[model samples]
Target chain A: MLDMIIDFFVIGAKIGLILLPLILAVAYTTYAERKIIGYMQMRLGPNRVGPKGWLQPIADVIKLLMKEVVVPSGSNKALFLLAPILFIAPSFAAWAVIPFDVELALANSDVGLLYILAMTSIAVYGVIIAGWASNSKYALLGSLRSASQIISYEIAMGFALVGVLMASGSMNLGEIVKAQDGGLLHWFWIPLLPLLVIYWVSGVAETNRAPFDLPEGESEIVAGFHVEYAGISFALFFLAEYANMILISVLTTLFFFGGWLNPFQGIPFVEEVTGWIPGIAWLLLKAGFFLFLMIWLRATFPRYRYDQIMRLGWKVFIPVTVVWLMILTFMIKAGVGPWFTGRGVL
Target chain B: MTVESVVFYLFATLTLVGAIGVITMRNAVQAVLCLVLTFFSAAVLWMLLEAEFLAVTLVLVYVGAVMVLFLFVVMMLDVDYASLKAGYTKYLPLGIITALALFGGIYWVIRSEVFGVEQMPEPAKHGADYSNVTELGRLLYTDYFFAFEVAGVILLVAIVAAISLTFRGRRDRRGQSVPMQHQASKEERLRVVSMESGPRQDGQEKTEKKKRIRRKKGGGS
Candidate 1:
């Protein structure tokens, strides 16, 4: 009994350790986005706070906390408040299953990938409820757009994951990384490039980031589902969105970019030197690269028009992912994967 | 008394409560949400039974997709909650009869030892690292292959049926062709011809001259 109690406490502490870093990362992701976007656009972004606005996220948090939370009249009060929690919970909850290092996971269950998928999928409720409960037509419209957009992209995204599942043959995130052990060339992206493209694109769409951000098209729908939200309520939604972006980036890294693995394992001196650095650093570097790509895309590309977004998701990405998945299925079944056979990701 | 039993009972109670909420809730959206809660709690109960794949897929399919879709429809439909309760007392006897019949049927099944507590013993406990997904997949592929295949085919048919029923291609609707839009040229859209500011020539006499002038422009020739 005493041992079990100690085990629970240890597990709790481990979870807290992961969560604190994750929350800090989430805060800094916003800061990094501003800085990167600023650099890209050749404008000074949020540099008024601490040195280079390092404390900008903290200031933003304080501002949100100090503001008054406004619930509109003729709104479903219960669900209005509940929406942000539903949205925020799943985004952070999915982190419990993420394997940062080889043995460092909170849950580390067999179905880590599916668990993440399920949690993210449930996040749609937040938008839907928030929109409906806002009692505003604009909010309703925004939420509806978010719902359809998420559902449409989810199909393509799910198919992309099917390709990864076929390649790795394990749903455990650690196993997925293990399967991709052989540096850059042996990464799943090489074999399943089409699926990788579909996955990454759908991931951006899933998170409702720029270009695919029809749900919150500020120009048209006035911030969409979150238009009616204010103060800390809106902050929760904001945090969830950024958190999801980080999640998607990490997931992309884990699924395709070979999470936490040295990209030059075969090279003699380089591999030995690279091995000295911890695996988590490699994972963060890859995920950060993807996150940077996201901000760059946001800075460069214009928001996607609504119909075009749908057409791309339903018509283009779906067929591409499905066909690629079929090809992948055959490739895996025939034992044709050169990466899997001899070296075993080295 | 045990942890498993406690968790199981907790989930079971919540499931029942959610089901009750589903029936009693005045708002249609709230009722649908209650149904979602019921489904989720039942999934938890299934997980307690060590059916991890079954439980996760339950949440994935029913709660994630089906309920959300249901919410989409429910939220769109402008239903007055007060009207939903109007016929409640009018159909009390019929409702009671149906409820009693369902309860009786369920009780009869449970009381009979065919699939009751006596016949259905607790499944053997697996190790901490046991993966039910692999086991389930093997069983699904081998022993239950035909049934699984049939289920998939039925789902495909259902999908086709639903699409056919609901999908209406609108000829009245005009949408932009992105590829055509992208392929469009400035010359195609705008012809910057420097014709004489006034009429080039007489009505009939200018036809040939107009053609010659257009040809000289070099784009439409």
Candidate 2:
């Protein structure tokens, strides 16, 4: 019993280690987004709070905490309160299987990939419930949009992951990363480039990020589903969204860009020098790049029209993934090149 | 009790509660939500059995995808609770009889003589390296390949039939041709007609002057 308690405490501390940094990252991501977009628009962003606006997210959090949580009259009180928790819980929970470095995860579940998928899928409930329980037409419309959009893109996203699974032949995230051990060229991104792009794009759409954020289209639906949410209740939804963005970025890094695996492997002098740098650092760098790319995309593109978004997800992305999956299968069967040579085919 | 049994009992109780909630809740949306809860609890129970693949797939396919769609439709529906409840008292005896019949049938199948601890002993726990997915995959592809393919084909046929039934390609319905939009050129949008500069006709000049004077008079007024 004493040993079990100690083990429990150890796990708790490890979870804290993952979550604390994750929360900080999510907070800073909002700051970075503002600063980045501000710079892109030829203006300064929140450089007013602390040194270089370092304390903006803190202030925001405090403000949200102090504010009153106004539950609209006639709203489903239970579900209204439950929505934010539902949204944020899965976003945080999906991090358990995400390998920071080799053998550095909370639970090294064999079905890590599917677990994440299931968790993400569950997040739709939060959006739907938030929208419905708000007892507002706009919120309902937003949730409806969100529900259909997520459902459509999820198919494409699943198919893309199927390609990754075929290439790596493992549902375990660690195994997937280990499969890409040789170098940068050995990464799944090269052979499964289309799938990677699809996955990244689908990830963006899945998170309801800028271009595909029809669910919360400010002009169209006035902040969409969580419009009725206030104070910390609202803050939870915000945290979930940003955290999900980071999650997508990290998954992209893991699945395609080689999580924790050094890109400088087999590069002679560079490899020797960079070998000392820890695997977690490489993982963070790759994930950060994708995060930056997501922001860059937000700054660059206009929000897609609702029908266009659906068309892209269903007609374009789904077909592309299917075709690429077939091609990948054929390549694996024929034993083509360095990629499909010795790796687990099916 | 052991931790596993405790967890099992907790989830089993939740499953029962959710099932009860599904039947008892007046609101359609609430009922659907209860159903989702039931599905999720059932999946957790599956996880306790160490059928991790099946558990996750249940959550993914049913709770995640199917339940969301179910909730979507349920939310959209304008259910008349009064009408739904009108026959409850009238059908009470019939409902109770049907329920009893279902219970009796289930009990008969699962009773101690046929399917109990002696008949179906607990499965041996596998090692840490034992992948349930790998074993399942092997069994599925080799032993039940034909059955699995047939099931997949049936699902495909249903999907095709559903799509065909609903898809109406009406020429009247205005839809954007995205490829055509992409292929659109500046020439198609705007034609720059180069015209030689010429002196204005006396009649045209007079009309222009009259219009300008009229505007001036209107402004003055």
Candidate 3:
């Protein structure tokens, strides 16, 4: 009984560790976006509610909780209720596969990259369902646009990952990072510059960031698929979006930037000298830098026309990735890869 | 059966039931939800098979992206629930015959297997690093690299086809001109006008004033 109790507690504690940080990070991320955008646009963002809007997300939570959920009269009420769960659950679940550090991850499966991709992809349904179930025209149009955008970008993203997988020879994120551990120069980014560019662009498009953010383009569809959503329902959608952004950022770090590997390698005093900072901090820092770029892109670029977005993904990204994939294959076959060996990236 | 076997059966049953629900359900939205259940239970089954990659991919791709799109389209279609019921009786005999044939064929194939050397029983512990993902990856990029590359090219072609089929310019649609927009400078977009000209009346002045009043009213209410 004592052993069982200890096992349950350990498992429960691990579950808590995953859930608490995710929920908290998601909540704060909203505040960070608002504040950052506000600063960039030259306006004060959410300062009245709490200290520099630190507690504003908390207030938003309270408001969402207190507000009565009003289901539209002529909607598929069952799906209407379930859509939020479908959206948020997969966003949360995808976190399980992300290896924050060598030791720290919720569930370290061998197919970590595939698992994350699959979960992130499934999240689009929530947006689609929200738009459809609302029985509203704007929502439907938004969802349709989102579906096409996500599916198109996913092809580019997957191909980009093919490049990373070739370099690493492993599908496991942990193993991928381990493969990148010689130094900064040895990282996949040095040799696979094309894949890096494609991955980053596709990452922006995948997360539905600005320039590619036609789905929620405020002027076009009045908040897109979530237009009919209000209160907590809207909040769930918000959480999912930010969660997805974080997931993509982490993936970019893991696949491209030798995740958690301090760039100044062979220096014994690097991580140990900075031992006050946890390994998870390095992962977070890399992820944060990418997140900053995402926000910067949002601030910098105008939303692309729907056709233009499609053209960019299909005509440009897909072709470029395919050609590079051929080159990478040839290099790997000829033993010209950065870390040349008989083993292809597993 | 042991606990593991019992659990496997439970998940398998759930997956099959969920799949059946997906097809038979009258409500299109309900069908999509059942599909989600089907994906989830199938993932559970894949866990039993030690095929974590395929299982997780099933959840991530099918559950996350594809089904979401499916649900979205299904929900927005303005589907006439009554019209669907009208067609069901008309096609009932054809459907029944097709279903029976499918089931029979499936059972026949499942029951008929080629004789091979006696299968090795799963060891209490497999050899060090016997991961399916690793072996699969090695096999794919080495011996199957040509097929993998071809599959990629096929997907690329499919993507091009999908885009071309859907791509059409709409003059009525108000969207940003990418080249013209990208050429924008800070000076053009933001003018440091002292709050001042007291929020200058360029293009959006009247609209902004109206919005401000409406926001005030809404906030007050």
Model 2 lDDT tens row, B87-198: 9899999999999999999999999999988999888898899999999999999999999999999999999999999998897988888999999999989989998676
lDDT of 1 by residue, B105-167 (tens): 988877756776778887889998889999999999999999999999999999999999999
Cα-based lDDT for every prediction: 0.89, 0.93, 0.81
Q: Tell me, by lDDT, which candidate is best.
A: 2
Each prediction's number of clashing residue pairs: 1, 0, 11
How big is the positional error of residue B170 in model 3, measured in Å on the Cα after superposition? 14
DockQ of 3: 0.39
Predictions: Cα RMSD each: 6.3, 3.0, 8.0
Q: Lowest summed-lDDT stretch of 10 residues in model 2 chain A?
A: A337-346
- Superposed Cα deviation of residue A253, candidate 2 (Å): 0.9
Each candidate's DockQ: 0.36, 0.63, 0.39
The order by descending lDDT is 2, 1, 3
- Please give fnat for model 1: 0.42
Runs with alpha carbons beyond 4 Å of true place in candidate 3:
A1-9, A267-277, A333-346, B1-10, B57-95, B111-128, B137-221
Better of 1 and 3 by DockQ: 3
Q: TM-score of model 1 relative to the true fold? A: 0.91
> What TM-score does the A-chain of candidate 1 achieve?
0.95
lDDT of 1 by residue, A1-346 (tens): 5665676688788878977887888889999989889888898889999987999999999999999999999999999999999899889888988988898778878888888888888899999999999999999999999999998999999889988998999999999999988778888989889988899999999999998988999899999999989999999999899889999999999999899888988888899877889888988999999999898889989998898999999999999988888877667666665555632322
